[model samples]
Target: MNYSKLLFLFLICVLQSCTSQTKINGVSFVAAGIPVTDKHVNPVVQVNANYATVMPFGFIKDLKHPEIIHNTDRQWFGESREGVKQYANSLEAKGIRIMIKPQIWVWRGEFTGYIKMETEDDWKKLEATYSSFILEYADLAQEINADIFCIGTELEQFVANRPEYWNALILEIKKIYKGKLTYAANWDEFKRTPFWSQLDYIGVDAYFPVSDSKTPTVEECLLGWEVHKPIIKEVSDKHKKPILFTEYGYRSVDYAGKEPWKSERSMNIVNLEAQNNTTKALFETFWKEDWFAGGFIWKWFIEHDTVGGENDSQFTPQNKPVEMIIKSHFEEQK
Candidate 1:
């Protein structure tokens, strides 16, 4: 080929790469051991989620102990490396950029953000073990050409207390991996995180409550976002890093907007409209913001084709009115 033709082709490739990284329309695929079919993949693409977050779990029994870094033996706790590779490949095949987000699931259902260590020795051990766990996936992320790698997720206590450990971890991950990096900080903890300057993006698991209504209107949800958005923008400006809602969404139940982050609430009514409207409000509020880099809706399942419907109460916005809201918003972005 002539030099000019080669230059044009090179420019095309550069443009494609730029768009892939900057476009943050995304969704979180459930960490299922088995691969999901085209039926599962098609919807995300249809919704214009150019990115997908794959969360495979790592287990730490106690804050005083090191993480148990076993990918194969314990099937119930997390997706295997093989499973992650398969799912990542599947997403890439459908033109989706992948973010390999490995999260810690503590035994006895304790929140990872609440983990506490009493001694320096325990902290050191936790850092070393967690580094090994993160580096293993760092290698996998490099091999798969994944777009981003979240070094840690919602380990609020550790991150707040041990800035040196996280800084070292980010440096180590950069040595071996060539993708963007971010940490998924819980809604209340992002401002307190001290390591944002070392990473590519500020990631928030944005489950901030927008309202307390059993049946919230889109305007009400927008009001909730209005109250919270200034803080998000201020953080982005302080660090000069774009923000990604690494995880966001609500359960399809009554009063979802009241506590978007809650795992369970006393009210049990299956209010699909509440879920759908809250989602619509959030998109309308955030999608146009220049500093907002988009988000991954909390989750989707591989075991089943759909998670949200008339009768369901979980966070997946699939197979319901919320799904259409997602689809329309994403399509508009494209």
Candidate 2:
């Protein structure tokens, strides 16, 4: 072979190898656990250190009348905003990618029974209320330099009926916020949502029942991913998008009969062994799935000031053994 031709062929091989190694979008494909800087590569595996604290935003409306129950005031906005910023900064300081979720659920206490957007006027009011809240939250996220911002969560009924409204809202958000965008959809109707193609990544609340019988054992809870994995893959294949477990949590409430064992006014704390076992099982099953971008735990705190009823112990990770598991998982990733 000619010397010039040999050199040209070698260069072509090098280019091909580089191209093959690279991934599309902002994710990077990795065999071992290694961080990839190039946005074009997709990560083979990643774990989320989710703090799940957004109810602070609802407290915004209750600022003026602290006496008024469940009316989140405006002053609380600044306080909540700062709290979220501090939390995001703390997570990012640990070299973790933060997915900041700004909640937009109807204040049931304020709205009485059901909240719906049945008419144009109804939607307009809803839009104004939520749009303002989202804008403020987005600004906070930008201030904190969060990696991902979830625009909304579990408002499936409203989002499904109002696609154009959400699209406009998202476009407006994109103008001010430059991070990735996603909406946490309810598990039952996530695929039916009309705006899958409109967002940066697919986010889902993947909390399928561990067992229809009683609360399953830790091993059973871990194996729940086996059922969810295929469902997630199907959604990804259909949409050609990466998946994030935006919300998945098991209630720690112990049960007496079929119903949750409720004390006079409080939910029983979940068995510590059960919680640890479940967390380990989840990590074992989901740590290596290539299609998953990451996931956030169900929650860190409750919305109401006082912890009562099922909210008292259902899903909060406060003081749980799982906290250590999360720290170790993130440290390993780092």
Q: Candidate 2: global Cα-lDDT?
A: 0.55
Pairs in steric clash, model 1? 211-258
How far does residue 303 in candidate 2 sit from its true spot (Å)?
Answer: 15
Model 2 agreement with the true structure over 1-334: per-residue lDDT tens digits: 9999999999999988764421111111111112223221111112233333233244223211211121233434223556556545544554445566765323333321123555677677666767877887787778777667888777765677677888999989988889888887767667776777778778876655443334446667656657766776888888877787677555555531123212233556545545455556666766566666666665443222233233344554444555566656654543
User: What's model 1's overall lDDT?
Assistant: 0.84
List lDDT for all candidates, in order: 0.84, 0.55
Q: For every model in order, what is the number of clashing pairs?
A: 1, 18
Writing each residue's lDDT as its tens digit, candidate 1 over 137-230 gives 9999999999899988998888888987778788889999998999999999999889899898999999898989988999989988888999
Indicate the residue-level lDDT of 229 in model 2: 68
Work out the TM-score per prediction: 0.90, 0.68
Off by over 4 Å in 2: 1-56, 59-79, 90-96, 108-114, 213-215, 255-266, 301-312
